[model samples]
Target: MTFAAITGWGAAMPPNVLSNADLSTFLDTNDEWITSRTGMKERRISHVGATEMATLAAKRALACAGVDAKDVDLIVFGSCSPDEQVPNSASGVQVAIGATRAASMDLNTACTSFLYSLSTANAMIRTGVVRTAIVIGVEHISPYMDWGNRNVAVLFGDGCAAVVVQATDKEEGLLGEQLGCVADARHTLRVRGMGSGYTNSGVMLGDTEWDFDGQEIFKRAVQGMVQASQAVMQKCGVTPDDIDLVVPHQANLRIIEAVVQRAGLPMDKVMLTVQRYGNMSAATVPVALNDALVEGRVKPGALILMPAFGAGLTMCSHLVRWGDRVTPIATIPDEMPASKLSALDLVNKIRDRKSQSHEASHDGLQGARLIGAK
Candidate 1:
């Protein structure tokens, strides 16, 4: 039987960091409060677009896998913040990397996007429809962020990571997965002014108002992830003790702890990045996976559990069995361009522009029935 193995992995993180102290300068929040509540000391603000970051990350992944761009047959771009909606972000990555022979598609399940993309590629590879694919989990959320609202604003950042998967005779990669969505609680974490539903409704683009019920989201996220984790492990006929590491969605420290605890896993086996990067939404799990590799935490022949939840109220857990190699075959010398602006400066500029263009119409969008509540 043919299996899909994760042969390459790379991450792109912006240089500009928006610290909690920086956030306190504008929002009615402090470092202690933000850190204690969300375990976020800082988050990245991208100087470039999401597409650029994804492309750079893909190149690195390709190099790591020692695979040429021409050999890739599929490219899956996973993100909620696309540089453009019409052309699709996957095509942009394909073009940037000169993967002229690959079929490009976009996938978004908010924070669970990467896991979903991984599953999609895994199935296609196993079915012999494709040989090599690049699955990217990326988010450039700073531009679309509702900076005026500390509730959501402080909880997200910008990042990207891509993994190269290829068909192999070895039974590695995704062994089992569970995917579900809590539609009833979807409105608890809605971002207004993003979709066509709000077009020409006096809701300016990038002028967003979040309808976030933190308590409700927290409760649902934990419950959904735990259930998915349990089911995926059971399906694979393995207990939590069989897993070597847990790389969970870094939405919040509390949520991660709650899910792991309920799954009967220990904290030492968990890989965490929330304190540094917050929630990069779709980018969270993949970036954490990359970090674990760099830290030498992912051993050869290890079994890894990834559980994540996203904005759709979407939830998923993936069971991955590692191959004999944990190190990259090659390395790419590419990196994101340096930023001239500080993270705080970038955020302030976005806030200022949004305030100027959207302040008057903000009320209309904020109170819209379709978005539920502000």
Candidate 2:
């Protein structure tokens, strides 16, 4: 069996941060209440675009992997906040990063997206179909959030993270995985808009409303993740004691604590980033993975368990072994062009085409009016 190693990893959060106090100015909530509940004092916001954030993340990951964009064979993007309804987000990323030769696509299993992408990438690598792959988890949750309502409004932020997975002959790296979904509870948490189910009926015409069941989602998230984690641990033939690190999704501190307790793992073994960056949806896992690597918390041959749970009633866990042999990529020069060609540029190009079409339609209407007058 071909081993899949995480050769590189990187994350990107927007410069502008929305603090709890800032949220209170717009929504009816105080800093103490928000922090005590979610342990998120601030979260990143992407003013440019979700595609921009995702591209930035992919660039960094590619750099860390010591690989050029041209070297990537596949691109799998997991996202809940896609910039467009058509033309999958991964296509935009592939063009943005200059991975012209790579096959690209997107997947959405709510917050479990990154794990889902990892699983897919691992399978492709094991099947001897691809050598180098990039898996990114990005979210622009601010767009889907209901600012008027404090319940769900304060729980999200924008960010993106990417990991470079490469095929190796080593035995370590991505040892086991477990994925589960509760379709009957899909409606427990969701943003009902801009999809085929809503758009085909014209019910979501220009509407961007986010409907959620906060209590139910919170309960399910805790229970589902704990169960998934246990199953993954068993599959890997290891107990909680054998785990060197537990990187649960950065949804809420409370949820993380609950999962740790249920798993009978020490709190110190778990990594937390929600305080610095709020629930970044699918980006949460990769962000934490990058942080752990930077902090020297992960060591070669260490066993790491990553469990992610999200809005689709989705829960996934990946058991990965830290391998010693990893390629190190050189850093990009500081003088690199600021006007970088990116996926966001590609999106703007598409938008420009749409605008030209509208203008042409208007000109045609004017010509018809002139003929009628004559």
User: Considering only N, C-alpha and C atoms within 3 Å, which residue pairs clash in candidate 2?
Assistant: 66-329
Candidate 1: tens digits of C-alpha lDDT, residues 295-325: 9999999999999999889999999999898
Stretches off by above 4 angstroms in model 2 are 200-206, 325-328, 333-374
Worst 10 residues of 2 by lDDT: 365-374
- Write one digit per residue (lDDT tens) for candidate 2, span 202-236: 44322446778877887888888888889989987
> How far in Å is the alpha carbon of 33 misplaced in model 2?
0.7
Models, CA RMSD each: 5.6, 7.8
**What is candidate 1's TM-score against the reference?**
0.95
